[model samples]
Target: MRNFYSALILLLCFVACKETTSGKKEAEQHVMPSAQAVDTLLKEEKKPAPKTFRTFENLADTTFVRLADFSDGFAYDLRYATKNNFLKEKVYDCAECYTRVKTAKALLKANEEFKKSGVRIKFFDCYRPNSVQYKMWKIVPNPQYVANPKKGSIHNKGGAVDITLETLEGEELDMGTDFDFFGKRAYHDNFDLPEKVLANRKLLKETMEKHGFWSIRTEWWHYNLKAGSNDKVANFKWNCNQ
Candidate 1:
């Protein structure tokens, strides 16, 4: 009778140990991932990289380039392409800002600085063709207002731009007068204006000057790239429909 009880106890102990081992095996199987799953976790999903833009390294300094093609950080309200300008007529077939590669480089750098101050460059005019200058002269023959197409202005050389500063929200800051306002109010030295207007002009002038551009006395918005003064006047026109 004693031997029979001892054998039964031993058999019960063996079954309990076996059940514990089986439970432990299932717990480990639930926690551990399969080899394929481990591979998937270690490998990253493939995705296309963003496109890189070309730099001016290979381009000539005089080569004309569309500003938007290099950087979209600028705002455009090309006045000559629309009748909103002083000419009261649309002289340009399209609204595109093209400048010499050297000029574009300086502009891009200047814009980068402006962005840090929560403002950006808004172009009123850029790279006016020699032919367009003649049309402007026909409407406003005054040398104070329009450059003679015969001699050609810095704008015809793809080196000059008329610009204003605006908040990132597109609200143009008060520069004392509207673009192409042919009067004393637009003069950079005319500090007789309000304090706010002078401040705005100062900001535009200082920031632009730091980027290798010089401002004319009469137009607060006009800036000429120092290097662009010598480039030949061009009649390069952009396609309107494209």
Candidate 2:
């Protein structure tokens, strides 16, 4: 009778242990993450947040010139070489010209207000080719007004703009020297300028600033649209006509 009881107890103990092991195995299988869930987690980890505003890279080439629809008579001198001293002899389409089309339209609308005041906007440089920019960079590697090509320029991206104020008669404003002049006369806060020139610069800066444009401290004529990300670099092919 004693032997029989001992054997029965041993058998019960083995069954309980087996059942515990089976329960543990089932629990582990149930708790393990699914392959689909793991893949989804990895995908989420890789994904970046969407930008709040549209960037230049997100835009098509055709979208860059949409501002032209809003205004007429604003000639693109880079489309054809003219005797304009401010223009580079080699014409090339500007990437920034397209990127800032919306800002350009705003500038045109603001020009209408300026026109009421007998003023017009004159562009010196727009989209510059990497080649031309490279040339300029070589000439003046560390210009106060211009950016280095090694670092990439707003002109390269079709986003940097250099312009000045003019009169309806085509006479340039006293905002100081000719455009692209590498001197203090082009400096934004050069107090040596005539009061009228200073006023004109102030007007241009204020108008551009109001329309989401920011000017460089070194060049009164240089302004960038604050619309796109700074990281966006454009290597768009330039057409002879911009």
Candidate 3:
């Protein structure tokens, strides 16, 4: 009788311990956080909030000028206007081309150092309107070379720039082809290009990148501000001439 009672007590203890272990295992499985869920939460926290400011229309009463006119440190020989082998039409209200202005100032300061090397910065295109961007897109919808007109282009926002290298006397270097050329030749790293052209492209790219500008891989002449997207849109109509 004593042996029987001890055996029964041991059995009961074993069953209770097994049930408790199973319950704990089940709770652990249900309460664990998924790796994906944690990653998603981290990403959500990293996103920046959008900003709002006064519209361009609200600043209509204030005077504005093209960045080029505001400072003489940089030089502008609008390539399109000349009877050269390049496009020749000005599509921006010069005064409202803030990106160009900012770029010019940076280049001017950089040129002081580049002048020792007999190199200078030149402008090919600046401050394009949405209308002209659409026209260009119709000509070539190359995503690597040109921005889509259906979407708001950085140029339309007055923050995109097209530029090249030139001699102090204003002679353009061989950058493979004209600005907006949609071909492999325009690539900064094209192996078939002459060494001089490649070197010139590298100089322009490095200098611009140093001053907070980034280059498009497909077009050597194209460089937009690294932080240009931060600029808010203005509803103020451009002053055709400033």
Candidate 4:
């Protein structure tokens, strides 16, 4: 009878041990999923939110707007913002592209057309403040290059842009001279250039004209919006901290 009791107790102990081991494994399985779920949630939270662009739906045409805030399609060099420009001095506090709402609209349309030709506009300068115009004039007091600050060029009116063509992949097209090149080589009428360069310039000029922009005779890169010419010359500066 004692041996039989002993055997019964052994059987009970084995069953209890098995239940404990199984429960432990089940608990571990539950705990592992909870840990993995927490990890996934953290990763999702750390991910950056997608960028959003502003629309010109109700904005006034004369209102100034940053081009990058509207679209990410175009490129910029913004030479005056750096010392690489003809002035050899950094004129702008920061590099930012801003234009009148009407000018921006025309540019967006022009960029779309340029994209069709596997190229896009790359700006060297745009929408210069009247104050910056004075800085440029002080550096080069030539009417042929820098416009008079008192008179205020189309740029100060937010109507002009110095731009060039580049491939969608960001390769600049050869147009015989770089931006701010003051010579006959950069002149629109001076056609003594390689066929490739002339073709590139022609593409830019024709496309810009189609999109309500007119080029200057002296500078192939400079273009003025036909409708934005009458806008007031602005000294409004962009906030660089943003």
Winner on lDDT between 1 and 4 is: 4
TM-score of each: 0.78, 0.60, 0.59, 0.82
Candidate 3 residues lying further than 4 Å off, grouped into runs, are: 1-65, 77-104, 135-146, 232-237
lDDT of 1 by residue, 46-70 (tens): 5455556667878999999888888
- Candidate 2's TM-score: 0.60
Better of 2 and 4 by TM-score: 4
Measured over all alpha carbons after superposition, the RMSD of each candidate to the real structure, in angstroms, is 6.2, 18.4, 18.9, 3.4
Best by TM-score: 4
Better by TM-score, candidate 3 or 1: 1
Output the lDDT of residue 9, model 2: 100
lDDT of 2: 0.65
Task: In angstroms, give how far residue 3 of model 1 lies from its true place.
Answer: 36
For model 4, how does the per-residue alpha-carbon lDDT over 4-78 read when each residue is reduced to its tens digit? 999999999999999999999999987776767989999999999987999999899999999999888999999
**What lDDT does candidate 2 reach at residue 198?**
86
The deviation in Å at residue 144 for candidate 3 is 6.2
Q: What does candidate 1 score on TM?
A: 0.78
Structure candidate 3, residue pairs in collision: 56-235, 65-95, 66-95, 80-88
User: In model 4, what is the error at residue 172, expressed in angstroms?
Assistant: 0.9
